[model samples]
Target chain A: MKFSVILDALPYLLEAAVTTIWVSLLGVLLGQVIGVVVCVARQSGGRAADMAGGVYVSFFRGVPLLIQLLLIYYMLPLIGIDVPPLVASIAALGLASGAYVSEIYRGALNAVPHGQSEAALALGFPGRSIWTRILLPQAFRISVPALVNELILLLKASSLISVVGVAELTRTSQTISASNYRPLEIYLAAGVIYLAINGALALFGTLVERRLQQA
Target chain B: MLDLSLLVQYGPSLLRGFGITILCWGAGCLIGMVLGFVLMLLRQLPVKPLRWVIRVYIEVIRGTPFLIQLFLLYSGGPSIGLRLEATTAGILGLGIYGSAYFAEIFRAGYQAVPKGQVEAALSLGMSYGSILKRVIVPAMLVSTIPAIVNMMAILTKETVVLSIITVPELMYEMQTMAAETFATFETILGMALFYWLLVEVVSRLGRRLEARVTRYLTHASPQGSSSETATARA
Candidate 1:
């Protein structure tokens, strides 16, 4: 293994690694927002609203995230709206991640028990206040693990944006390998970087899980 | 942004690409099944080194991203003196990626099977192959069918990535036509709709397969009479 080449490539890869993390953060944040709306709509919604949310989730969850990325990055330009790589990546990732996160939120919301919502409603509180204070706090606690999983997946799926020339960690490694013919080493290093990112995420997830449990 | 004229222009091209996507997905899923079963068997083997190989395969595949894997296979393969056709490389990469996934799903299915059933088979004079083929494989298929079906949906969508390697799949076709016509909106929106439709059909098929697998496993009458000869006959 060419340790020196990997060392040389690290500086380049690190910048792309930052882009990966940034995109993942933006995607996960957007996904969580969409997820909440979807979960709430599906749970306390009329038939039409519920179906709308359900269909959104089904479409996003059923397809592969990679294709979704490709569709976003490359296909939009066909119609004269050329989105930058980062924008397209985030939009695609968020849409897909939101579907999964909504499921997690749905499970969490359900775990809050009917009695809780009933108690809030029965107390003569406004419906918005009841859902925000009484139900959401409880739901967030239960869905932590699932949300972490979605985030991890988003991180990996971010690598796919390389197809659109978003110079993320994988692309940087590919560039290095192409120049030097040490793919096994370069790729392995890229894998380690991912492992580090994901490992940190997992640790954070576990800590959050513990905090939720203590609550 | 959408009108009938745009639809008419791109519809046939997108549909044709959809067919190619389905073809690649079908081939990839089938190859994945064979590779997954072989890997699972390797992992389950009594030998220690063979087991390590399986562990390594699973770890490397699951840990890395598919995009990177594709890059390695497509770009790196030639450098290694293994000149592969682009489509062949795509299919192989898809198979490799899907196999790691399928192995995990099948392993879960195997774990779900009752230990008592395996013991009952062993109590009789059933050979390993017969016991596995009759009892284990069928039982594993029950849970695995649903997971496999779900994987098929994912695989269908993933075929779009093959476009990067010039596979002429729907996504690639859409890209070319979009770039060619400067009608980005028409091409991508059309492609997305086709992809959505394709996945919807696969999901329906998957649900049906899953239902059938579960139904058959749950209610199929025992063919091998009683425990005494159950293993032997199996």
Candidate 2:
């Protein structure tokens, strides 16, 4: 590998890597909001709501994210919805991630014994307080590591957004490699950036798991 | 609304694409399982350096997106004089990518095998290979089949990314048809159904395998079976 090419492209690639991180962060944030809603709806004990949640999860989970991205990016314009590439990319990633994150949420919620909510209700706590104070906190603690796992997966998946012409880390490396004719060095450098980001995320996840265990 | 006639006309092309997709996925998973087994074995070796090297390989592969890995292999290999056909590159990339996850699954399975059983095998004068072959492998296989099936589903979806490198897989064919027909939604939805069916079949098979294998375990419990099925669904 030519070190010089990597050195020359390091700053540019890092800038694009920042874009990758932010895009993924935004996507996952959106996913969390959507996932929480779906999780709650599915748990609400209404048949129609449960079926809707199931359909949402299955459709998003079953269809590959790349196909979703392409569909959103291309078909939207055909139907006159004209969104920017970034919007389409984030929407696709967020919607797909919502499905997975909702599953994580459901798992964590289930792990918290039903008695906890019953106890809260028997204690005369307000309904909102029962969820926000009693159930959600416990579930959140149990779910942190899984959420982090999903986030790391999302961060890596953001690279697929490059297909829609987002100048993320992978696409940025491809461009630099094309210009410098140093595909090996450039891609290796890009891989290192990805590894660094994910390594930090994994370490953070472990820390959360440990702290949760101690708690 | 889907044009039923268009689907009928495109049925043959989609079937051809589906065949290629399965070929790539099957070949990739085969190579991946072998390499993953090797990696898991190497990780348990007494050599610290070998363990470290295997750990790094797994982390690097698992940390990054498969799309980047595919691009690097497909594009960078030729520059380094490792010329590979598009299909070869796609298969190699998928295999390497899947190996990391498979290695983890196998490692978990290895750890899950009760130590008492291995000890009993050793005390009975069984060779190490025999213990692994006769005892550990069977136990691990029974417990880890669900995880392996889940990985297969993931890898099957991953083959879609291979289309980027010009593999004539189902996704590539569908994308080509979409471009040609400009009926993006119809083409995409049809492909989605195909993928959904494929995943459903794999999942159902995993459940059946779990049911069959659990019968072989002495400590088979209802709770254990349910947990394994839950993991498969996840």
Docking class of 2: medium
Residues B77-140, model 1: lDDT tens digits: 6656777787788888899999998888777767766788899999997998998899898877
TM-score of each candidate structure, all chains considered together: 0.87, 0.94
Could you give candidate 2's per-residue lDDT for residues A187-215 as a string of tens digits?
A: 88899999999999899889889988998
lDDT of each: 0.79, 0.87
For candidate 2, write residues B10-68 as lDDT tens digits.
77887898888999999999999999998998898999999999998998999988988
Chain B: TM-scores of all predictions? 0.87, 0.91
Error of 2 at A162 (Å): 0.9
DockQ of candidate model 2:
0.69
Off by over 4 Å in 1: A63-84, A177-185, B1-19, B46-49, B221-234
Residue-by-residue lDDT tens digits, candidate 1, A22-105: 999999999999999898888778899899998898878765576577666766676688778879888998988889888888
The alpha-carbon deviation from the true structure for residue A173 of candidate 2, after best TM-score superposition, in angstroms, is: 1.6
